[model samples]
Target: MNKIVDLTLNYTNDFTGFSKETSRTIKKDGWNASILTFYSHCGTHMDAPIHFNVSQQTIDKIPVSDFVGKAWVIDVREVGSKGLITVNHIPNDVLNDFVSGDSLVFWTGWSQYVNIPKYRDELPRISKDLANWCVDNKVKMIGVEPPSVADVNNIEEVTKIHQILLKSVVIIEGLTNLEKLQSNCVELIALPLKIEGGDGSPARVIAIEKQ
Candidate 1:
């Protein structure tokens, strides 16, 4: 049996960068469909290097294989509001086993405040040191529960971290329900819309719990 946990923030008409219009309904059109308007980088999304001008590669240009991988979660629940996350936060055992191509996830408890301003304005963030560490370690992808891996309000911090990490690895953000994952490691699948020339796109991210 495989246990799959959704690691994406639920979206709704009220959420930021998302709007839904009833285009068709069972009662009106004998079917059900809606027009969804979404911002490419909103909600649970994957960032392409081009998002930060790190490269010309768009989300669609990223290899599909890069979206699937064995991902290890580093529990950073104690990383309080606006806390700084460094490589030291990762457990030694996990770090010892971590290798090139293995994705990394920071399981911060920030998702609980998704509906509030703090979720974006005062979220915990990954430090520049950690970003560089990921690059040096050749991490394939890095996931974070916050809407962003760095302080979104700080353009310098956000741009620097995104550039440092995106240049070397793909990024998954705005994740939720990571606490539901029962294992330290899981098979991660995060598929983004294949928009041509897209800087980034919202992704449906899930984790197949280790069995």
Candidate 2:
């Protein structure tokens, strides 16, 4: 048996700061479909290197294998709101447990603040040093339970961290319901829309736990 956990945030008008209107619906037009107006980076999404580097690979150019991998969750929720997440927050055992090419997801418990101002203002951020650590360790990707992996309040620092991580790893942001995962290790599948030359795209991220 396999238990699938959805690690995606439900999209709402408030989610992407976009006004969504329906020109067609099952009740009105005999089908359920609506035009969506939202940023590619909005909601649970994967950031490609092109998001930071114009000359880098786009969302479509990234290989499909990168979207699927063995992932482990690290519980860092002990860090409070607006806390700084350094390598010290992670123990040596947890750091050493990771093998190269593994997807590391941070369970920061910040998804509860989704759609709120605190989601961006009070969200905890991964430090530059920690981002560099991931690079040095050859981590394939990093996911977080916040709107961003970096401090949204500090644009420069956010850019720096993104640059550091995007150099070698895929950055997955805005994940929710990570606390529902019962296994430390799971199969992570986060496939983004293959938009040509897209910087980023909202992704449907899920974790599969085998029983």
Candidate 3:
């Protein structure tokens, strides 16, 4: 039997305090509810090229083919808090398993800290070399459990990483529940909301294990 793991964070009005509620009624009748909120990149999300570069592709402009592919989950949990994942963290055997156009998921165990201050302010990041390697190897997409690949406080590094990866590979960030999959390889399907001209959009990411 195969397994499916949802790699998305739960969005709530008070979770991150980033959501807004219009109404909640349960007195004598049923309920018609709505929410007013603003989140460009909150949950499991995909960053389009426009996120870091002007005149670049927007969320809706990205090819749907970029959202689905064979994924290789590289475990780097051994590198402790605030660690940086570099080319060296990736094993040669694992690199050998990747072919051009494969999706790469970094399992940094950081997803455990979603919605926390430290997770947003001090998450692990991918090194420039690793970012370059993803491009050179023709990776279709790169997924990380952290809020951003680079430190959220460091705009320069963050912009550079986004620019590098967004130019070629789709950048999937703020992913959760990857640790539940318990598999090295899986088919990843990440579909972002079709927000017109948006820099990024929340996504529903899933991992499908093969028999």
In terms of TM-score, the best-performing candidate is: 1
Question: What is the C-alpha lDDT profile of model 2 across 1-211, one tens digit per residue?
Answer: 8999999988888775545787788888899777778798888999989787834799999889888898888889988798778888776776778789988898999999888788888889898898998899888879998889888778898899999998888889999998899988899999999999899999999999989
Instruction: Name the Cα RMSD for model 2.
Output: 1.6
In angstroms, the error of model 2 at 74 is 0.8
- Tell me each candidate's RMSD, in Å, in order: 1.0, 1.6, 1.8
Q: Scored by CA lDDT, what does every candidate get? A: 0.91, 0.87, 0.85
Measured against the true structure, the TM-scores of the candidates, in listed sequence, are 0.97, 0.93, 0.93
Worst 10 residues of 3 by lDDT: 21-30
lDDT of 1 by residue, 42-150 (tens): 8899999999999999988999999999999999988899999998998999988998899999988888888789899989999999999999988888999888999
The alpha-carbon deviation from the true structure for residue 135 of candidate 3, after best TM-score superposition, in angstroms, is 0.6
Check candidate 3 and list the clashing pairs. Answer: none
Give the winner by lDDT: 1 or 3. Answer: 1
Residue pairs in collision within model 1: none
| Backbone clashes, each candidate | 0, 0, 0
| lDDT, residue 123, candidate 1 | 92
